[model samples]
Target: MKQKIESKIQVKWKACNHGLKPQACQHWLKIYFADKKVDELEKAISKAARDPAKYGIDQPALERRFKWTRTTMTQVVEYTLQAVVGTA
Candidate 1:
């Protein structure tokens, strides 16, 4: 079930013009849930942290590579959080 939701997010992300790779989406989800203060999406966050090659980012280089604005990034995070928590 978790894998199914992850795949759904990947497909939705690809369908949109986010101009980011699947890894980037995974990274965003990780950062948002890393210190969420709630138990929501714990499994997903743990999985992301366990695989840096898949979800980790170079902090210094992200500014140059990722084009998303803070507002847009927040929106994605909120959307993902809602999807995960609301569905569960």
Candidate 2:
């Protein structure tokens, strides 16, 4: 299930007009999640993403990158949560 969600995010990202690879997305998710559980990460990002300013300058791009069904957000959220939880 986790793989499915993450894969969806990857797929959405690949469909973007992005010049760089999707690694940046993964990297950012890692940094953002740093110390949270999978579910927690999802909850965190989903909530925080409500505010563009909080997310910062790359907002437009990142927001578009995550454009898609629940899958993209699911991936972003889950990955972040897992990374955070792992660190903790």
Candidate 3:
């Protein structure tokens, strides 16, 4: 499955290299990173959610720093999780 996805991405990248599929190439690449961020956020939240961690330090810190709500953070994580895991 991983190989198949990589193969598809390689095809898209090759098209970008030829300068013919700019929009499709850019869109998939952007989605790839966005999905990656979701996995990362999930890991961070898992770590902070452990014992001796009542303070808001992980994803919450990022949320506070960025001036967003806890709801938005969870929503983004859910979106990313569905994008990555759902596709698989």
List the candidate 3 regions with Cα displacement exceeding 4 Å. 1-7, 52-54, 57-88
TM-score of each: 0.25, 0.26, 0.47
Every model's Cα RMSD, please? 13.6, 14.5, 7.4
Q: CA lDDT of each candidate?
A: 0.52, 0.53, 0.56
Residue-wise C-alpha lDDT for candidate 2, range 1-88, written one tens digit per residue = 5565455545544544465446655664554444234456456556657775776635665455445424655666676556435533
For residues 1-88, write the lDDT of model 1, one tens digit per residue: 4355556665655644566566656654564454353334444445554564687745444443333334454565567667656533
Ranking by TM-score: 3, 2, 1
Stretches off by above 4 angstroms in model 1 are 1-68
Q: How well does candidate 3 score on lDDT at residue 45?
A: 59
Worst 10 residues of 3 by lDDT: 63-72
Write down the RMSD of candidate 2 (Cα, Å).
14.5
Predict model 2's lDDT versus the native. 0.53
